[model samples]
Target: MGNWKLEVGRMAMYMSFPVVLFHYFNQPTYFEEWVTKTKRNIFPPENPQDKEAIQQLIKDMRTKQIQQFEGE
Candidate 1:
């Protein structure tokens, strides 16, 4: 069997291995681009045409609703 020092060293290694990995991997610079790219892929930038179309659709719905209430 090993001495106390050897046992302590083993325990320290077990505990610190994950801590060291977390410290290095949690840095934003390491994965910020990756996260941003994934976000862009999931939700691409909105286009002007898409915005205009959405506004027009909303306006049409509102107008139709007003007309229905007025006609009733």
Candidate 2:
């Protein structure tokens, strides 16, 4: 019975971990900062042409995000 209880407690803790992680990582400031950093890391602009493309992509993403939140 003690072993069963320990197993159940471990299972419960493991189940709750994803919920805690989701809550922590989904906070807007953290999520946005992570996204910005990831984008910069993955798509560093090289030249003027690349910079222009990046700017347009940023503009489009922001506009879409605004519309999505406004709709919500």
Using lDDT as the measure, the top candidate is 1
Q: Residues 5-54, candidate 2: write the lDDT tens digits.
A: 89999999999999999999788986797889999999886898888999
Write the residue-wise lDDT of candidate 1 on 1-72 in tens digits.
Answer: 999999999999999999999999999999999999999999999999999999999999999999999999
TM-scores, all models, native as reference: 0.85, 0.40
Residue pairs of candidate 2 with colliding backbone atoms: none
Candidate 1 runs further than 4 Å off: none
Assess each prediction's global lDDT (C-alpha) against the native: 0.99, 0.92
Clashes of 2: 0
**Residue 61, model 1, lDDT:** 100
